[model samples]
Target: MTSTARAAHPFITSHGLKAALADGEEIAVLDVRETGVYTHRHILFAASAPLWRLELLIDRLVPRRGTRIVLVDADETLAHQAAAKLVRLGWNQVSVLAGGTDAWAAEGFEIFSGTNVPSKAFGEIIEHRKHTPWIDADELQERVARGDKLVVVDSRTPEEFAQFSLPFAHSLPGAELVYRIQEIAPDPETLVVVNCAGRTRSIVGAQTLIDAGIPNRVVSLKDGTMAWLLAGRALAHGRHAALPEPGPATLATARDRAEVVARRAGVRLIDADELARFEAEAGERSLYRFDVRTEQEYVAGHLEGWRWVPGGQLVQATDEYVATRRSRIVLADWDGVRALTTAAWLAQLGGHEVFVHAPPALAPRVTGAEPVRVLPSRAAAPLVSPLQADALLNAGQAVAFDVDRRAAYERHHVAGARFAVPDRLQSFTAELPPTQTVLLVSPDGVLARIVAAELAARTHRDVRAIAGGTGAWAAAGLPTASGAEGVLTGDDDHWYSPYAHADHAARDAGFRAYLAWELGLVAQLEREGEVGIRLIPAA
Candidate 1:
């Protein structure tokens, strides 16, 4: 069966979009191409929502259905298709970019090449405006050799810190720096140096401490781990030394300091009533309520209805979390420090009205993971249990296809299963044997079921989804295979980070190019005026 026909949507010219952005109208610009393709070329502010996973991601990225939405791609074809899907999903105000990125570039507008361009550019602007202090790798090494009373803090996520970090560096993610710095470095004279994979988080993390009026001397490690590698320094791998929780005294002091910083940055403090008002108006005005604490803390207990987005990742990837431009954002945490600290940076980021709230003393809390909103599939495919699937495969009566991430498929999959890209399933499955039953599997059975129904309708063949997907297969003592045995589409769905490069020379080159791109963001921001980043004077 062909795709359901959709009415053509209205188009917005590049000039129209530029003016709307300058006027500060609420809008979300989404690029519907696959992630790898989007990284090569895209609008400077567009967020990635690939067509294949659009249903899974749209509710999180663009929560407000009525909010104005502009779809973009390399050409207009994908954008139009995405617009149709959005319209069917209850988005009343959706339009395609007249000619997509090509039109925007032809009109002399700057086109960016990278993921998270807006957030990285905002970081460069922060560094440019605040002149955040920095120390080179040589100086840091010398200080360490001299046994100076100093602490090196990695500002990336705990997972990133575990992958690689500086010698003796502690993992204190960016938002936690302000909330726990006093405890981490109680001695006023002890130096604090923050680092990340590259420039953005390093600068933002160190600046956060300085802005909060910390007495300790704080500086970002220049160029972060990339510079250390360039300086021929070896990094420690598999380290997980996150700082302990702040005590009551430390929490009190941090709250006071963060309040001052938030006030200075013009972050409004709202009570429960005010937050309810914002939630009530969410239908007309886009509102995002986030619990800005560590995932562990958030999972233990959090205000119901608040999404858990660790503050550090929220600041580093604002575009991903809050796609609706000029939306109202409410941040909350048990202690005021995390919410206030995150709000200060977001308030300065501009375009949005940022607020902070502390949950009531006896507010109802939810436990476990946050709930995800996904579009319901039009049809459900028949499901087979692992034992049933194993029997069919053993009899050579069924072919299994794993429709998950390439890395996941490479790590482990059902024996004799071929990896398939969700969007490329039609072309990829055409070469398969026609008589055998087709079995689909994903990380979970959700995507598999959705795609299996579509494939069965199109191919008029027997198709079934593996119940509970690969996890269930592994749990049932089934044989599995590793490595790239049958990868039909290679690395076409996801963007590869510079650090993910396999070859040392290629990885080093990627690091250099990434650093250069970050350094040049400030100049690009200047060329593209009205980008909506405003810097508040550092307190």
Candidate 2:
């Protein structure tokens, strides 16, 4: 039983921390530093806990009682986030160490070093974002409402969409876009827009669409939904949700269309060897490379310098990746579906040096390395979990997630689940929580396996994927609510809201309202996840 959560105050700067200490309040200061730093020296009476442990041990470390907690992490966001989580876990009061250790030392605070150093993976996630470009809410909303004929696609997890999203955006997510573009976004003439929670997926999503060939234009929404909110733009409000994947038939059609689109858009093919030669020859040229998998996958392992980019953001971040529309690009996932789609988008953006397929996973880092396997792979199998279904949902440290069509995700999901679908798995460098092992939830582990491999390929984050996906959640007897959204099942469904309305429709459902509602849901779910709930399957 976790402790009752308390409200947290915005962190004080390094100087601010000294003032707090001088006040001598009976506060529990948490140091989220590498165990090494803690061991060498630390603020008097500061507890040493890593972020990873917090995500996993919150239930035990935070009892269902009352306590005041303070979090201190190197990155500014991490400490603030930790303080927020503490509040959720029933703390009476929570504060973040503003300057973390650096500030403490500046105030003549003592610190310690440990023989066994704490892992710096959590610290790394922050540094990675520095290299990323961000757009605020006002700027992004202006673009969305600019009526520039740009399409804004929400590349977040379906659950995230259910929480809230940008005004007039669609929940496309990252993993499944490659499989469902034709049904969700069949129009090839409109400018394409993409976004995610932050920089990683948005940049990666835009890049994905650019790489894949399409007749229309494509761009990424800088800084994603959060930026939009910060910019003070109004978000469309609604309580709708959906899955971000596609059915078999829809996937096939999208794949077929991708091949044709690439051909029409002039997407070229290159093996590892050719890619290497091209990179060598294209000196002084700026090129953007991305992986359209989940962040966790990229953290586990990935090609060096291959940015862990999600496919959904490809439409928004095209500007950041390629400069002046003359750069080279390469991409791949479990298959080349996302790569081709992104390639096409690049061409639509007026890029000439576009190559739409990716070499095998084991292909050498060099552009012109030996071929590991042929590409343009057949549809991959979805993933599944191994344990008893109900156990997966009810077990300690368990989290239920959605891994199907975008509509299914927006429609409903087991409570307290985090989404890391396949399409955006490649941006691990910029995404992914450094703490806690990952358990991927999907309809079945079928799609989960494809996403899992992508995470393993990108980062060293400890990773594990649940099979049986959301099916396992249902099987595990977890609570579920209905009315969530699913993808457009047929040609008649409105996959791209506000753009394509089928027979008998009013004003097209804009993407802005859809995204805002979804982002709200994600925030809500984070709060609701603290309580334990068990579901009885409908007999």
Candidate 3:
């Protein structure tokens, strides 16, 4: 068992965790291990928070620092580190699980295993309870081969769609389905099929259309793209067709449909004054206000303090946004469709007072400061310009490491810069060639400063950050490479959908695991005992 010497931040016993759960108290239990390990197994209802990014993400994950926070790790090392960081950051009620997850398992509590388990499980429950309709992959493939009049709408983001999708599929991410479907399939005779990398979004998207009473026959692609590949079908790559802007008729239809769905789900439409009242009560209760729209739409213009969270992702990853279960959530969108639909789903999911804020106009008013940007916690070291870095590198006195995501590095990076994984810097340090100085570069200066601080502490070599980041470097007309170079760590941060893998065996295994995880969700829901979900039966 872990020692409880640090009384300032006490260590809660496994029994204490169980008692808190049984009592239905307001608490945030976080599993501070890497996603790879956390996905394998973790205490039920515990949110994933890898120690590497905990500081940067803590504010968003648990906005109320004083809320009782219980951190758990499989081992003692990470939980203690995370707890210390929280206390230093002014969290008054931080605690660690005594003996970590081992202690919890000894007490015989159910430990969940999978990524986005709640969302995936909820999807399974939705299908079982709501009986969402779907067309098998073989049927869809045969229809396509026979040149049927059909429209395939991929319910993933444009970026994901661009990576891979079914042939002739147009990009129409979740929440946009109700708003844009009429334009995509103008003819009622068109057989509309919705698909994602997997089942959740596909089912949700298809159900959204069905609930809206669309004349088009909308159905989810069974088991999503994984089933497509499993049926010996080929996938389309690098597709970019996007949902066109809704015409007047389509927009009016969407608005009317949204109102019906909202009314059915008992979602309230509050005006600006009511929203103000909710915000004023923040001291007594937490209020999470969001603009449920695309990032581009959000960045263009949004209400003050209204952060952007695409409706689909918000529903799919509830734990990331609303850690406090019973807190109030207010959603806003330019159109009624996204906000109303998202509010309906949130209300059905339970534990929160959910509402849709209906503004006078659909276009976002240019109000409020930009969203909070996460930066390094500590002061940055001395900075160097990209030109200065180039000179130092040419002389072999310095080495440059691009600290951005691998995809970004592969898109464009400084010609000689190596792709360095920040999480694995300690292990990768030995592989770096001997140099008097090390230069760190990121998409923005923030990550570089964070990494520079760590390198300065660990090595004797001089460490510095690039003044701006890759954007600045590119603007300076520097030569760049368009592929990943000298990648030091595996890209495990992003858990791709099982349908995304090209390997038949790997994809099959992923689908099986996904199905198994989802199949057991109803049992876990019973174990959790507090998840508020009321399925809106199929219309």
| TM-score (all chains, Cα) for each model | 0.94, 0.30, 0.87
Model 1 per-residue lDDT tens digits across residues 120-224 = 998898889899999999999999999999999998999989989887898999888878877779899999999998999999998899888889999999999
Per-residue lDDT over 337-408 for candidate 2, one digit per residue giving the tens place of the 0 to 100 score: 666665665555443366744657666553322222111112322233445433644564433344444445
Residue 536's lDDT in candidate 1:
71
Q: Could you give candidate 3's per-residue lDDT for residues 1-539 as a string of tens digits? A: 23456544578898888777556556778888766567777876688876656656777777776678889888676787777767767677888898888878877777787776666777777777878889999898789889999999998888888988887788998888888888879999999999997788888788878888999888999878877877777788988864688888889889999888878888888888888898887756678888888777777778866777788888878877777666778898567688988887787776678888876675347754455655354445779998898899899888888875676787888888888666566556656665668888987766787778766765655789898888888889988888645665545444545764558799789887886666678788777666567777666
What is the descending TM-score order?
Answer: 1, 3, 2
Report the lDDT of model 3 for residue 197: 79
Better of 1 and 2 by TM-score: 1
Error of 3 at 323 (Å): 3.0
Instruction: Give lDDT: candidate 3, residue 417.
Output: 85
Q: What overall lDDT goes with each candidate model?
A: 0.85, 0.49, 0.77
For model 1 the local lDDT of residue 128 reads 90
In Å, residue 370's CA in model 2 sits off its true spot by: 23
